[model samples]
Each structure stands twice: as structure tokens, then as C-alpha cells.
Target: MSEAVKEAVAEPALVAIMEQLPKTEVPARSPLAHHTEVLSRPTHENPGVRLWENALRTHLALRGDAGSADFARGVEAATGLALPERLQCHQSGEWALSWVAPDEWLLTGPGDQALAMEMSLREELDGHYAVINLSGGQTMLRLSGPKARLVLMKSCPYDVHDRHFPVGKVVTTVLAKSQATIRRVGEEDWELVVRRSFADYVWRWLVDASQEYRLSLGHPE
Candidate 1:
């Protein structure tokens, strides 16, 4: 056998598996679709907490070596956002990257761009790295307003004070009876990423917790 033929046969074939969005015009339903009626209600004056589901967004669970320069550069090249530090989040344009653990990060962006983003990352990253599509398994909710911290305090044991959970920080903690990856996007605004199964429960729990200060539902920002 010729050396040229052996070399060509030794190279592994690249396999690309792309996830496609539904092609039909059928409307996509959110995990909290059943509560649409309540969410569509008018906001009350001086509401303390404004809540809404940031539905249908792309969520990718990324696992890679953060210490590798190639990994960092490749991710930034693909998403245009730096990989966040421990318990932190970095946002650029429509995308956000949150640190989930020492070697894992979460990447989120517009729903329609998930496939493209994943493909880009796969192409840029080399060696041992993984990118898993988590868009279908989780849902994101936004909580904001004056008493948003109070609502968080009521639900989790984590000290949500600005000094502790400052803006741009992300923490995976217990939220009510479930777990959520909470990100402090602003001084008064928070974003919670929860499993689809626990989304309804978490939403109701938060709404009830905000009742003392007046709760209202609004479109996600």
C-alpha cells in the first residue's frame, strides 16, 4: 500500500450534526405558556418586582479547559464575548457567557442563531472540548424592580445583597424548592435560568413572594 493512501485513510472524517429550528409556521410555546393569561395582565403602578420568561432563547452548555489559550481565544472568536470568571457573567450584544464551574460555562444567544454559534465554536475549538445544546431543557426568567433582592432572599439562603451578589455575577443556588442559575444583570435586575420542569413552580413561587411589594408581569428585556 502507498504511504499517500495510508495517510489519507488515517485522517478521521469530520462529522457535523446541526440542530435545526422547526420549519413549520406553527408557533413555539414556552414552558410557561399555560400562564400566559396571567403574564399578559396589565402591570400595577409601583410594582416591586416585574417578572417575565425570556423564552425561546438558545442555551449551550460548554465544557472545556479554561486555562488553555486556544479555548479562550476560540470562544471569544465565536461569540465575541470573553469567557466569564468564577461566578461571573459577560455579555456582548445578544449573547451572554456565564461560568458554571471550573471547566464549564454556559453560552446563551438568540434562538435562531444557536446552530450557527455552535458550528463556529466547534470549528474554532481544538482538542478536548464539548458543546451541548441545552435550549430545549431549560428556560430563563427575568426578575426586576425595587424589591427584586428581597424576593431572592426569601427564596434562597444565599445573601443577595449587592455587596455579595454584585452585578455581572452568576450563581447556581437553590431557588425556592428548585435550583436556578441566577445572574445579576443590573443593580435591580436578575436573570434566572431554571429547568423546564421546575420553571412553573419557580415562577409561581416568585410571583407569590413579590405580592407583598406588588408583583407584575412584563415582557422580558
Candidate 2:
């Protein structure tokens, strides 16, 4: 085989799929659209936990060899954020990367930037790696305030104590009756990545659980 042919054969056809938002000015309906009345309510004084849907953000499930130096370098080169270690998350600007498993990570960014980010990743990465756009399948919810940890403890069986959970940690665990990929984003803030179908149920459950300490809705950060 000629050198030119070998180079052509080595390059794989791009297979990454990106979900595009509507080009027109149509109003987007989130999973919690019907609950706007509840979410529109004003925040209570010193509420225990503040709730909001981080809806429509881009979510990408990245599968590759974490042990490979090339893989790590390519991901950072593409996303401007490092692939996190086991059960950890790293955020830079509008992008966040969370480790889901030994060889899997979740990359999230602005909803409109999904396609561009995926293309960048495809350009930088090679070999047995996969980049899947999961933006449509999932939505994120932010839970934060003074009593956020207490609310999480009430919902999940996992030990969410600061000593164990800590900042920058992520976990795939139970949230009330449904499952969620949970991450601690700050000393008092946590994020829940849940399926669109389960978003309403999870939101309702959190509202009920947080009532004792007072619950209020806020815009996603």
C-alpha cells in the first residue's frame, strides 16, 4: 500500500452525533415546564436548599482509556478541562468534566455548544474512543444552600457527609426513588444529572423533602 493510502485508511469516518437546537425562536420546554408556577415562587429567607433545573445544557458521555496519556491530552486539548479521576469532577469556565467509571467520563457545556465541542473532540482523539452526545436524554438540577447536604442525606442511602462526599466528588446513586449522577460542585452546592422522564418526580421529591427547612426555586447557575 502507498503511504498516502495508508494515511487515508488510518483516519476513521466521523461518527459522533450532535443534537441541534431549533434555529427559530421557539420557546423551549424543559422537563419541569409544567411546574413553572412552583419554580417561579420567590425564595424564602435563609432557605435550607435552593432548587433549579440546569436544563438544556449539553451532556456528552465520553468513553476511552483513562490510562492512556494520549487520551488524557486529547480530551484536555479539546475541552479545556482535564478528565477527572475516579469519582471526581473538574470544571473550567462553562465546561465541566466528571468521571463516571474507570474508562468513562461525562463532559458538559452550554447547550448550544454541543456540536462544536464534539467536533473538536473528534479532531483531537484517535483509536478506540467514543464520544456520545447525551444532551437530550438528561437534565441537571442544582441543589444548594445551608441545608443542601441534609436534603441529600434524606434522599440518598449513600453517605453524603462532607468528610466522605467532599467537594469535587461525583457519584451515580439513588435520589429518592429514582437514580441520579450526583456531584458536589461547591461547599454547599450539589448537582443531579437525571433522565428527562424522571426530572419531574425527582423535583417533586426534593420539594417535599426540603419543605421542613423551606424550599425555593432559583435560576440555574
Candidate 3:
């Protein structure tokens, strides 16, 4: 094949590997939009537990060979954050990369940056890898306050004690009968990524379970 023809054929294949985000005018909605009233309720002066929806943030499921140095460097180059170790999380400013499994990781950032971020990853990465957008199908909730750990204790069987699940640790576990990718962000702060279908059930379950500890709606950050 001629050099020009060979280049033309390979270029399309490279570009075709990525699925671009559709441009649309539809407004993004949070899974908990119907709970505006409850979320807007006044918080107690001494509330022990607080909850808020992270809402509409970009979620990308990444799969590749973790052992490959090229893949790791490409990810770090595109994301500005290193691929996290097993059950760990690495964050930089608003971006976070969390280890989900042996070959899978989750990358989340500002809602509006999905397309640009995906493009960057596609451009930098080569060979066998995948980046699938999961934003529209899932939402994140931020749970914090003095009793946040207690609320998690009641919701999941995972050992969330500080010593075991310290800051920057991530785990996928059973939460209130639903599954959640839970990340410990701080001493009292946690981030839970849950599917849209189970968001309502999980939110209400947390609210009810937190009643004893004085649950309150936290201001969205």
C-alpha cells in the first residue's frame, strides 16, 4: 500500500476507537432532584451527620493493564493524577482516580470536562485500553460530619474504621442492600458513587439510618 493510503486507513481506525459524547441541549439532572425540599431543610446546629449530592460530575470507567508502564504514564499524563494502587485513591484538585478492580479504575472530575478529558485520554493512550463514560448512569453523594462513620457502619459490612479504611482508600461494597463505590476522603468525609436506579433508595436509607444521629442536609460543595 502507498504511504498516504496506509496513513489514511490507520487514522480512521484510531479515531473510530473512541466514542465521542453527543452534543445536546438537555440539562443535566441529579438523581436526587426530587428531594430538593428535604435537601434544603435547615441543618441542626449540632447535627451529627450531613449529606449532599455531588451531582452530575463526570464519571469514567477505565480498563487497562495496570502492569504496563506505558499505560500508567499515559493515564498520569492525561489525568494529572496517578493510577491509584489496589483499594486506594489519588486526587488532584477536582480530579480523582480510584482503583476499582485488578484491571479497572474509575476517574471522576468536573461535570463539564468529560468530553475534553476523554479526548485527552484517547490521544495519549495507545494499544489495549478502554474509557467508558458512566456519568449519566451514576451520581455521587458526599456524606460527612461527626457521625458519618457511624452511618457507614450501619450501612455496610466493610470495616470502615479509620485504621482499616483510612483516608484515600476506596472500596466497592454492599451499602444499604445496594452497591456503592465508597471512598474515604477525610476523617469525617466520604464519597459514595451509586447508580441512578438505586440513588433514591440509598439516599432515603441513609436519611432514615442517620435519624438517630441527627441527620442534616449539607451544603453542596
Candidate 4:
């Protein structure tokens, strides 16, 4: 037998999987929990910019060979959604899988299901791949209203025009001074996934930028 083949048989990769969330119930708080007053206040009638938090949802960073049939099938088997093409996003029920890079995607679902989802992916996937639970390190925010596009224009250097950034398009770009995975969900609705540490900075930046547009804080649905 070839030495290369012998070496491959002698050594195997080790993968460690663990539950990222606490086993016991614990009070969960979002990055903006301390800004309750600011988020709960009223705004002008027919406010032009409405904001809210998706908060604490499970975020999984998935990496695999998009060109492989096994990779694609395994992802669909584990996620129940197709692998999104470049700069695209696919949603099935409460789960959304978005393409973040050539070989990377972001999968988000109910907050409590991070471990289950991660396990399922590990079970179905083979070969070199990675699934990381980022639920505790980042959060999602929703921004919608007539002036939402304008707000995005002020924040991101990327052209957010309707033609350039159609619905279901995902782009990781600069937001204020931090970076955000921005997705266009609807005509005027957008979702921003930011790091937990930068959540406050992004929120405050949006608030100040939307001042002239009459900002309103909406309850998450």
C-alpha cells in the first residue's frame, strides 16, 4: 500500500461538538437591553424610519465546498434550504441561509435551536467543513420604513439602490465604522447582522442618522 494512503488511514480528523447555550435556563439579554427607554419611546405619526431587534437568534457560520454535490445535498438535508448562490439568501420558514463568501454561509434560526441545528449539520455533512455557533457573539436588527433606503445610503458606501441591491441580496459591507452583513428583505425593509460589541454603536449611529426622518422604535414581531 502507498505510504500516503497508509498515513491517511492511521490519522483521522477530530471534531468536537458542544452545546453553546447553558443547560439550565438563564435570563437572556440582547445588546440593547439597557436602552429600553430609548427603544420604547414614541415617535412622530407616520414615522419614516422604524427600527427593532431580531435579538438572540441562533447564528451558525457554515463553510464548505459549494461546487460539491455532496456539500450541497448535505446542506439541504441539514438546513432544509438550498445553498444560496453568491450574494443571495434563501429562507425556509423561520430559517434563513445567506451566502457570506465564496465558501461560507450564515444560517440563522430560533435562538434555542442552535445546538440542535449544529448537530444536524455535523451529522449530515462529510469531508472538510466547519459549523460555528455565533449566537452569543452577534445579533440582528431590523430597519424598515419609507426612509430606510436613505438611512442605508448614509451608512454604507455600497450602492443600495433598488436596481443594485434587489430583495434577497446579501452583502457584508461597512456600516458606520463597523461591518455588517446587510440583507434586503423587502422593498424598504432591511436586516443588519452586527457583532454584539458593535450592536450599540450601529444602533446609535442609525438613530442619529434617522433623526430627520422621524424614527420610531417598533416591537419585534
Q: Estimate each model's TM-score.
A: 0.91, 0.90, 0.90, 0.92
For model 4, residues 1-221, the per-residue Cα lDDT tens digits are 99999998889777777676676778889888887787657577788998888888999999999999999999999999999999999999999999999999999999989999999999899998999989989999999999999999999999999999999999999999999999999998999999999999999999899989988886634
RMSD of each: 3.4, 3.5, 3.7, 2.5
Instruction: Give the top-scoring candidate (TM-score).
Output: 4
- The order of the candidates by TM-score, greatest first, is 4, 1, 2, 3
In angstroms, how far off is 9's CA in candidate 3? Answer: 12
Q: What is the TM-score of candidate 2?
A: 0.90
- Comparison by lDDT, 1 against 4, better one: 4
Stretches of candidate 2 off by over 4 Å are 1-16
Of candidates 2 and 1, the better by lDDT? 1
* Model 4 bad stretches (over 4 Å): 1-12, 23-25
Between prediction 1 and prediction 3, which has the larger TM-score? 1
The local distance difference test score of each candidate is 0.90, 0.89, 0.90, 0.92
**Candidate 2 overall Cα lDDT vs. reference?**
0.89
Residue 81 Cα positional deviation in candidate 3, in Å, after optimal superposition: 1.0
lDDT by residue for model 2 over 99-215, one digit each (tens)? 999999999889989988988998899888999888888999999999999999999999999899989999999888899999999999999999998998999999889998888
* Model 3 spans > 4 angstroms off: 1-25
Summed over model 2, clashes come to 0
> Weakest 10 consecutive residues, lDDT, candidate 1?
13-22
* lDDT (Cα, tens digit) per residue for candidate 3, span 58-169: 9999999999999999999999988889999999999999999999999999988898898899889999999998988999999999999999999999999988999999
Poorest 10 consecutive residues by lDDT, candidate 4: 14-23
